[model samples]
Target: MGWLDGYVALVTGGASGIGRAVVKRFIAEGCTGVGVMVRSAEQAQGLQDEFGDKVLTLMGDVRSPADNQAAVEATVARFGKLDTLVGNAGVWDFFAKLEKMPIEKVAESFDEIFGVNVKGYVLAAHAAAPNLRASGGSMIFTLSNSAFYAGGGGPLYVASKHAGVGLIKQLAYEFAPEVRVNGVAPGGTVTPLRGPVSLGKQGKSLSAIPGFEENVANVTPLRFIAQPEDHAGHYVLLASKENSCATTAAIIQSDGGWEIRPLR
Candidate 1:
């Protein structure tokens, strides 16, 4: 029996990067079904090709309330109950400094970055709350070391992730004693995390940055960059009642010891 035996889950941004890894891992852990919210038909087709009926891929934008709700309803409908909600969709600001942008650009970038990273999570939580409460399930969000430290991204991206910390705390409080809410903060991982369109970086991916992996490895205390799979287990643990019971409003830092970075 796997950790998530017979479980059902809904994951946003489940097409690629850390989000995709979580969907794959959840199924490997014996999830009965995983509802994936993706933005493109290609993503939906790719998931179907890989996981087949094990996953139900829904094409939609994470910033949409109806899409989030549809994903939740679809998961419970297919698997009979919802056990986990993984709010993993997000956008980065590519380290776009605040002072460099005009005030108007800043506003647009903030909306785009926060729309995907912050508001998306909020909508997913709202949609999944009832189901999670009914099944005594948990909510796991994909945060970043940026949520705490700096230099992970630009002002918009970093600030958006920081907002997630508070979101988790508030939601955990609202759903206490019945459902748990938590987060996984990953360091520089080699995934195709996208940038905000507001900055004309929508076509660019995080991993495509020149020497990104090497740079991340050199700076990180662990001397290595992470892969999406490295953080997937944290989500599994948070989703498992046996492992993380009584744990709520907590964030597990999986960023290669980010708290002790800079090598003193």
Candidate 2:
């Protein structure tokens, strides 16, 4: 039997990248239904075409409180309960150093990046808390290696991930004996991770950058770039009460040896 047999989940940004991968894997592991939060009609249609009635796609911005609540409500309404919340939506800063951007632009970019990366997780957790608590379920956030060490992104992106660390810990503490809270930190996966609009990079994606795959492989200790599927199993483990019941306020480092990168 699948680890998540009959489980119900809601995933933010579940239309693309790592989020989409997690949804695919969850279904394979026997989830009854998954509610996916997407930004466009295209994304909604794409999920429907792929997963059929087992998936419900909702259109909403992750940064909105109303949208987060609506997504959670819809998931429970359709599936009859909620077992997991995967807060996987985020924005990158594209390595824009603090000094390179004008102060005004930096301020705007910071807000946009943190709005999706940090606040999105917080709001999703808040919205899903009651259902998760009711089922003794959990919350799994997608973090990055940048959450622990530097150089994953510029200050704004890095700081946002670091904040996610604190958020997970605090939530785990507060939701103790019931809902668990945890994270998975990946490094340099070839996803369509987008940059902030404030930096004029709304149309740009991380995987579309020239030499990105090569550059990531060159610097990563594993000497290989990861696929979105590579990190999807971690979410499954964190979501499975039978598997990771004791895991709370902890982060699984799926960064391919990023912590051991050569000091030279």
- Model 2, span 1-264: residue lDDT tens: 999999999999999999999999999999999999999999999999999999999999999999999999999999999999999999988899999999999889989999999999999999999999999999999999999999989999999999999999999999998999999999999989999889999999999999999999998889999999999999999999999988999999998899889997
TM of each candidate vs. truth: 0.98, 0.99
Any runs in candidate 1 off by more than 4 Å, and if so which?
Answer: none
Candidate 1 at 35: error in angstroms?
A: 0.3
lDDT of 1 by residue, 55-123 (tens): 999887889999888888888888899999999998888899999999999999998889899999999
Best-matching candidate per lDDT: 2
Best by TM-score: 2
